[model samples]
Target chain A: MIAAIRVFGYSLFAIFIGLLFMGIGRKIIARIQLRLGPPFYQAFLDVGKLFARKSITHNFVMDLGMIMSLAGLLSTMLFVPVAGHMAIKTSSNLILIIYLMAIGHLGMAMAAAASGNPNATIGVSRALTMMLGYEIPFFTVMLGLIIFNGTSSLELIAQSQAGGILNWNMVKFPLGFLAAEIALQAIMGEKPFDAMVAPAEIASGPMVELGGKYLGLAFLTHAVSIFVETGIMVNLFMGGASNVFTFVLKQFEIYLITILIEAVFPRFRIEQAVKFLWTVPMSIAVVQLAIILL
Target chain B: MMDSPSYMLSKIAEKDNLTVYELFFGPNHPGMHGNFGYVLEMIGTEIVKVRPNAGHLHRGFEKLMEQKLWVQNIALVPRICVADPDPNEVAYCTAIEKILRVDIPDRAKFLRTITLEMSRLSSFLMGMGALAAAVGLYTAMNIMTADRDLILDLFEWLTGARVYHMFSIPGGVRNDLADGFVERLYKVLDHLEKRLIEYDKLLFENPIIHKRLKGLGYVSKEDAVKYGLTGPNLRASGNPYDVRVDDPYAAYPYLDVRVITQEGGDALTRAIQIRLEFEETINLIRRALKTMPEGEIRLNLGNLSALKVPKGEAYAKVESSKGEFGYYVVSDGGMKPYRVAVRGPSLPAGLLLAQKHLPKMKIDDVAAWMASLAICPPDIDK
Candidate 1:
């Protein structure tokens, strides 16, 4: 019962921080364009409004799929160590976290297919293809880190780099860091790599039929995923931070960098985006892996 | 579940020749610029057929013009083209002025030129923003829209209306330029000139934008002329045909209007051509300000309600932001025009040209192609 309460508390904390990151991202993009943006807590209001509205369901799968998507991402968050503590205390294996993350995306894909929209299907297919394109390079870079540290537990890898900024993996593995940055851009669906959700092209792609409560659940799932992904990046490269405040600040910095790129660039076609991922970043990851092995 | 889905699959597979899926591409959608829909027959992702559906913005403009008196039609014509309404008002007024045989003052002509260029600047900004939006660069769209609103501020100061300004009347403009309008306009133009460089860096030089738009919608020089494409679309195809230069109207006869052209005849060329012409439009506005002839701002056409035009017919054309917008007016010695017809520039681009080009394009390119062509649905439906 105590563990259940802890799990609930951690999920709420992750969601709150993730939604705050989203709101700040909007403000940053707005300031760049010389406009007064929404308040910093606007994302919370948006989710609240979404939950308050009525929703339509095409079939039983839509509701089940949405709940499954949220559940999948939430479960992934449980395994990730936030600052220095884990909601569910098992040795944090990097490979387990990666595999668990895919469940969330697959659940969303199943829900999108259940919606019976061609745009949704096309979006799901492109999203899956993009996942394939980014994962190869990401795993290669992660493999280099795992081999160098001689451990797969995220907490141990982060603990090894805890002395100072100079000891962070970002300073040591510069080439791997660069490759991982590009991979992260694709993973987060930022500009030049966001063809799956191209609003003008496919009418918002997978989220076409999602409305009301279903959309709220989707938004919550996205928030949790953001926390999980950025948390992993911080633990891997930014020394995991000594406390919660510093950890969240580093996550904010990473999210800001992504939004900065998104504000300036246009989207690529799906094929071009995949090709770019495979050629440039993949080769860089291979070189980084070679150095780690030697 | 397996039996149900298989039955449905077999039902779909029964039609061997019907492999295409039908999609309604927006009478109401984010990608659609306005109230326009396309019944697209798509095979996989490629568009196999395109049936352009319009009339959502139709207000019976031609018939409505026949009902209103000569002076009242000025208010009606501006509604025909929302993005660039000045062209319609100017064309209608010029047509009636031709029938009434009243020569507008030089100041009015120059003022008309200024307004026309300002209208073109606003419309081009909207077109550029839409092009960016189509390619998923919404930040660029927002920036362009904010800049376009600055120009609208100038319009509000001059005409007391933000969008539909019934400034142009039958004989000339309803009022003269407001106090210090030239100084404010110069400032706006300077700001826009500086912003264009940033816009180029963000969108024009973007590798992804180049990949998506470079050769997507190709219109050859011969095909352009064959299909009656005008404005920047025709200019992109290496045709140096501009109604402002070849068939000068209003103050265009006095001004040296340079017709800009490009050789590519593709979407990139069209976009670059508009950017280049936008600079020229800014220069033209400055030149008109420097050499504006001083005289009466309007011609008194007697009491508007009692005014009667002689029995005659005249067609007047203006080089609008979209293309050549012409107004044909038939006056049978009456207060109301006998017959009025609008040769809107968007008819050929939205209906004829879209039908010809949209057949083989990938469905994703449909919005981008329409944006580069700058087809305004209101003009088509009007």
Candidate 2:
């Protein structure tokens, strides 16, 4: 019972903070475009309104898929160390965390396919293709970090670099860090690689059929995704913070950099996006791996 | 078994050893610009066939104009093309002027030129913004939209109506330029000059945008002409044909408007061509304002409601923001027109050209391609 409470508390905390970050990101983007944006708590209102509305379902699979998607991300977040703190207090294996997070994407695909929306199907297909593109370089870069530190546990790698700024892997393996940064942008589904969610092209892609509570669940999933991906990046290179406040601050800094790029650049086609990820970031990751292995 | 629902489902699932799926592109969709739909046949993400469905926004302007008097039709014609309405009014009035043999005052011609150029600026801004929005760059869209509002402000000040200004009548414009209108127009132009540079850096010069747009939709010079493409779309294919230059109307005869052309007939070149013309439009507005003569704004046709046009047929064409928008008017010495026909620019481009190009295109390029082509569905349906 105690363990259940602890896990439930952590999940709620992650959801709350993630939603807050999303709201702030929108406000910042709006300010960049010279408009008065929504309130900083607008995400909460959006989620509230979504959950309060009646949701439609095509099949039993859609209901299960929505639950599975949210549950999968929540499970993935459980393994992620937030500011040197883990909710489950188990081995924070980087490889295990990566695979667990993929379940969320698969769950979304299942729900979208179940809803029988072609746009959703196209979105899911593009998303999976983008995943195939970005994951290779991201995994290779993570491998370099793993080989350098002689461990696959995220907590150990983060703890190893916690002494000072210079001790951060971002300084040691600069090429890998650069490659990981680019891969992270794709993972977060920002502008250039965001063809999966291309609103004008595919009617917002995977979320085309999602409405009411299903959309709310999707929003929560996205928030948690931002948390997990940024948590991993912060732990991997930025030297995971000793406290929750500073850790979230580092995540905010990373998200702001992405939004800046998102504001200026246009989207790449799925093929062009994959081609770019393979050519530039892939080469950098491979070079970084060679240096680490040697 | 043949009539069962399960069998029907199975039949839809498989067809001729290949899964053929039908996708609705709009009528009500974010991907489409206006109330337009495309029934697209697809095998996976590759589009196999496209059937363009328009007419959801059909206001029946041509038939409606035949019921109204010649002067009253000024209010009706502007509704034909929403993005650039001035050209519709200019075309309609010019057609009537050709029949009535009324030479508009020189000052009215200059004012009409200014209004047309201003209309083009606002329309190009919308086109650019939509292009950016299609590519998922909402920042550029919002900035361009906000800047476009400044021009609308100038319009509101001049004609008292921002969008559908019944400013152009049968003889000339309804009213002269408002007080300090030229100074305010210059201010808006100065602001646009700075914004255009920022837009170039943010969107046009960005390598990612270049990759997304360049060579995506290729319309060759011969194909562009063959397909009846006009204005920037045709010019992008190295054809220096502009109705403003080829058949000068209004103040264009007095004003030396430079026709800008590009060699590449692709989406990127088309976009670049609009930006180039935006600059030329600003320069033309400035020249027209400077050389504008002071005279009567209208020819004072007695009793606007009961005015009778002579028995004649006249066709007038104006280079709108989209392409050459032509108005054909026939009069049999009656208050109402005997027949009125609008040769909208987007009909061929939207229906014929889209049917030709949309097939074999990746599903992702459909929206961006439409936006870059600037297919105004209202014009097509009108």
Candidate 3:
């Protein structure tokens, strides 16, 4: 019963931090464009308004898909060590976390495909193609760290880099961090890698058919995703902070890099984006792995 | 009875077990510039065939012009191309002036030139913004829109209306240069000049933008001429045929209007062509303002409502932001025009070029292609 309460509280914390980051990100983007943006609490208001409204569903699969997407990400959040605190007391396995994140994306693809809109199908295909593009470099970077640290556990790696800033994996493995940074940009669906959600091209892709509560759920799923992805990044490279506040601050720093890049850059075509990922980041990751092996 | 090309294609696709689906890409889609749509047939993400679905924004502009008096049609003409309305008014008025055999005062010519350059600046901003947005760079779109608003503010101060200004009439502009308008115009130009460097950093120099736009739509010099392409699109393909420089309409002959052209015949070249011309337009406007002679703003045709033209036909053309906007007018020596046909700039690119280019292109490139070509839907439908 106590463990269940801790899990619920941690999930709420992750959602809140993620939503806050999203709101702040919008404000930053607006300022970059020389426009006054919405308040920092705008995402909360948006989610609230969406949940209050009515929604249409194509079928049971859509409902299941949306729920499973949110659930999958939320469960992945449990595995990520936030300030050295795991909601479920088990080793934060990096491989399992990565595998779980794919389920979230698969759920969204399934829901979008079920909607039967050609644009949505195109979006889903692009998204899946993007996933294939980013994951190779991402896994190669992770493989370097796992081999160097002699473990696939995220918490153990964070503990190993606990001495100081210089001891952090980021400083030691700069090339791996650079490769991971590029992969993270795709992972977060930012510009130069955001063809899947190209609003001008495919009417915002997978979210085309979602409305009302379904959209609200998708927002929550995205918020949780931001938390999980950034959380993993911080644990991997930033030496996972000693407390929650510092951990979230590090996550914001990571998210800030992506938001700044997102604000200025135009999207690449899916093929172009995939080709770039395979060439640039993949080679960087391979070089980093070579350095570690040597 | 069942011998349609689409049906035959579908049957062939079914034999090969290829799933072909139809997607409507506007009238409601965000990427579309106006109330225009394309019925796109697709296999996977590539567009197999495209049927341009127009008439969504048709207000029967040519027919509407016939119903109104000659002076009253000035208000109707600007509605044909909302983004660059001045070209329509200038072309129509120039045609009327030609038929009447009236040489507009030198001061009026300079004023027309100023207004024409201003309109081009506004249209280029919108076109560039739309192009950036089509590639998913909302930051560039937002910045360009904010800058465009500054021009709109100048327009509102000069002419009481922000858009659809019936400022340019047959004889001259409705209002002379207002008090201190030139100083304010210069100030805005200076501010825009500073912003251009920032725009270069944010959009033009962006490598991803280059990757998305480079060679996406290749129009050769021969194809550009054969397809009846005009304006910056034609200029981008190494063609130096600028209506302003070649025909010398309005005050262009008086001013040092140098024709700007690019050698590369691709979407990126077209974008750079607009950027180069935007700078040239700013310089041209500054020159016109400085060299403007002080004289009567209009020819004072007594009671313009009762004015009639001689039995003659005249076609006058002006270089708009999109291309050459031509007005062919036939007057029957009556209060109203007998026939007025507007030759809109967007027709060749929107209708003709899209047919040639859109097939085999990916779905993502359609909006960007339309934006790079500056395909205005209202002009196409009109």
Candidate 4:
């Protein structure tokens, strides 16, 4: 029972951290260009209002989508270590986390598809194409970890790199971490890679069809996703929660990187996105793998 | 729209469970720059068939001009196109000028160029925003609007209104450049030059945008002319025809402007052409301010209460930001015009040519192609 509470606590905490970063991130990006932006609590207010409205689902698939996303989110949380330890860090659970992430997207896509809007379908299609593009490099990065750590267990992987915060995957394989950083930015659906939700092209893509309570759930899933992937990056590459300030520091850095790129770059179309991931970022990941093999 | 060849797409699906359906991308989609759409037939991933639909915004500006008074039409002409309204006002005014044999003061010409160049910059900014949005770049779109707002602020200072400046009147302008406005404009120009570099980093140099826009909406030189494409669309296909040069009016004959063009008539070419034009517009404004002849801005409409002309018909054309806009007027020695047919360039470029070109692109690309054409809805509806 204590294990369940621990898992729930860490997972919720990570999500809260991500939620906090979204509003703060926008303000920082705005100031970089000599302008003032919204306050720190804006993210909370925005998310809160989304729930204030009654949940309205376009169809039964919408119901399934929210439920499945919540389920998959919890399962993935079981594998990710927070404060240097996971609630249930079994070896195979780390692999399960990857599947959960993939399946969570699948569920969201399914719901978006069932909304019966062309824009939604287009959004889902772009998201699928992006997933296909970014996942290859992500797997390669993971393969390097599995080979080096010699275990699928995320906790074991974290423990192997434990030191006075200097020994981490980022320091050991800087190239891999660099490649992963760019790839994760794409994976997170940040700006310059957010083709799926292109508002001008398809009216915010898939979310165009979803409204009311379904949108609220979808928004939460996205907010949590920012944390889930960022937490994984922190644990694998950066030292995992060495202290509260360190944890906050690393998370903010990740968020800052995303915002900076977003403010400075334009988006790619689906075809361009596919070509970029398949060529540039993928080649960089291969170079990272080559260094490890040598 | 005529039939799309549908030759490029290879069939991946069998006849049985998956049926091919035609989806009409109407005058309603966000991508459809103000009243434009395409008929798209898709069998899963590939677009096997397409057709461009237009004319949702046909207001008959030409036909309407014949019914109104010579001065009354001045108020109506600017409504023809929302993005660039100055040229229509000038085109109509110049045609009336020809009928009345009124030689506009040198000062009026300089002030006219100032407003015209500013309108061009504002229209191009709007086009940039629309194109960015169509290519799925929300950040680029927002950034464009943010920068475009500064230009609008300049317009407000000049004309006291934002969207519909109706500032260009017959014979001369409504007012002169206010105190220190020219110096302030130079500052705005300086700011614009610096912002363009950041815009390059955000939208232009970014490889993703290049991939999406570079070669998507391809139109050849011969085809561009045959289909009546004009303005940047015509120039993008390697044509150097601008009414500001080919016909020469206002202050363009004295002003030095090298026409901007690109060999490939695609979305990227259109976008790049706008960027080049933006730099040139700043140059044009600076020259107009420097060489502004000291004179009155407004010409009295009271000179023609009866609005009598020499009973001879005249036609005048001006290069709007969108394309070449022309006005052909026939006066019968009356207050109202006998007939004033306004030939809006966007009609041929957007309605007729949109039908011609949209068939060549995928359903998702419909908006980008439409925006590149730069069709203002009021112009089409008129």
Q: Estimate every model's Cα lDDT from 0 to 1.
A: 0.89, 0.90, 0.91, 0.75
Interface RMSD of each: 3.0, 3.0, 5.1, 7.4
Worst 10 residues of 1 chain B by lDDT: B1-10
Best by DockQ: 2
- Model 1: colliding residue pairs: none
- Evaluate model 3: give its lDDT: 0.91
Per residue, candidate 3 scores C-alpha lDDT tens digits across A168-278 of 999999999999999999998898899998999999999999999999999999999999999999999999999988999999999999999899989999999999999
Looking at model 3, the pairs that clash are none
How do the residues B1-382 of candidate 1 rate in per-residue lDDT, one tens digit apiece? 5444423533554564647766778887778977988988777778989999897888899998889888888888988898899999999889888998989998999999999999999999998999999998888889989999998998898889888888888778878887888899999999999998998898888888889999988999999999999999999999999999998888988889989999999998898888899999999999889999888998988887777999999999999988999999999999899999999888888999898899998877888999999988998888
Between 2 and 3, whose TM-score is larger?
2
Q: DockQ (C-alpha) of model 3?
A: 0.56
- Stretches > 4 Å off in candidate 4: A1-11, A29-36, A54-56, A85-92, B1-17, B22-28, B51-68, B303-312
Arranged by lDDT with the best first, the candidates are 3, 2, 1, 4
- Which of the numbered candidates is closest to the native, going by highest lDDT? 3
Each model's chain A TM-score: 0.98, 0.98, 0.99, 0.93
**TM-score of every model?**
0.97, 0.98, 0.97, 0.90
Give the winner by TM-score: 3 or 4.
Answer: 3
Q: Residue A210: error of model 1 in Å?
A: 1.1
Model 3, position B111: C-alpha lDDT score: 84
Q: Give me the overall lDDT of model 2.
A: 0.90
DockQ by candidate, in order: 0.57, 0.62, 0.56, 0.34
lDDT, candidate 1, residue B30? 79
